[model samples]
Target: MLGATGLLGSKIYDRLHRNGHEVLPASRATGVDAYSGQGVAAALTGADVVVDALDMKTMSRRRATDFFTTCAKNITATAAEVGVGRLVCVSIYGADDPDAGRAYGYYAAKAAQERIYASAQVPATVVLSTQWFELIEDVVRRASLGPVTLLPAMRMAPLSADAAAAAVADVAMNPHSGPTVVVRGAEEADTLDLARVILQERGSIAGRRPRVLRQLPYLGRAIAGGALLPQEADTVVPGGIRDWVRAAH
Candidate 1:
């Protein structure tokens, strides 16, 4: 498991363990930096499969693109070299849809990451998911400016990170799940509204609270349009913002 210390990664590690698979987690904290090509080879020396739950949490285009592409290259190349049979990557929905946030750098970066795995010699499974309901706080933290919060005027089926993790673990444990799988939330929602709920429930984030919230559709047409919503979901996670917030606190 790559990025084993991350929020979603930790959940995935748990699920994989519950599924009775011996999991060895790899991340920067575990001395396995996929981007730097350090300790990755040794980590997968005898591993049969690798699940990359690695996440680059940033709104910056260049940073996100660089991080994903570099890390994907290193992981795929090294996995192929070490004779790993399968690679399971965790990504977002609409990563391959050009109209779905192509102008958004992070979307483009994720698309590039998917392509890297697709072209690899090792067989790979790409698990695409809608944004996790748990991520609203992180999004709020990044988008907040002083006493106000500005977010994308986007639509999301707010999936729970826990459910998404289960989907990844399922694909990791099975060989016939296919090359791609889409996991979505139970309900379609607005990002602006999700942010509002986050602030109202949490009161403040990172020691600061935003009294005002706004949403803009400037990031990309896909963000505002229905391009990012899942059309066919192999895994429809059961939860919404309200449920997430209730368990969040």
Candidate 2:
């Protein structure tokens, strides 16, 4: 596990460990840096499976591209050197589609990472997942300006981080031979609706009325509509927006 302390990676680590699998959780805290190639080889030694759940905080195109490409190159090369057979990568849905999310630097970098995996010496499986329920807070924060919030008129299907982590663990342990697989939530929703739900939940938490004008605007340069929705054939995880909101309360 490359990012064992992350939001999704920690859950993956716990699930894999609970299943009686010996997992070496690697992260910055564990002194493993994929960019500098520090402490990666020792972590890979005697390990058969390599799960790349690494994440970056920046959205800069050049920086993100460099970070992902360098990390992928270093990790894959080291894995191949140590005789690691299976490489599982966690990625976003629609990353393979060049037309989708072209305006976003993060998505573009993700696409580049997928290309690296496709051409890697060791066989790789990419687990494509939708947005997580935990992202609602960040979305609300980014969309907010004073007492008003502008949401995108876009559709999204979001799953819990736990569900996504479970899927990753299953794929890593069972070893999916396919190049890519998708996992998503049980229901589809618009961005405005999600924002409303989150605001209402927060209001209830604080015991004060929520005051915010909600408006729908085009999300980004590229996200028009249905770009974030999962395919019909994609694996849908259990639970929906209402369930998640209720649980959050």
Q: Per-residue lDDT of 18-127 in model 1, one digit per residue for the tens?
A: 88899998877778989899999999877888998888867677898899999999999999899998999999888677766366878888988999988989999999
Clashes of each: 0, 0
**Model 2 backbone overlap count:** 0
Q: Ten consecutive residues with minimal summed lDDT in candidate 1?
A: 199-208
lDDT of 2: 0.80
The TM-score measured for candidate 1 stands at 0.91
TM-score of each: 0.91, 0.91
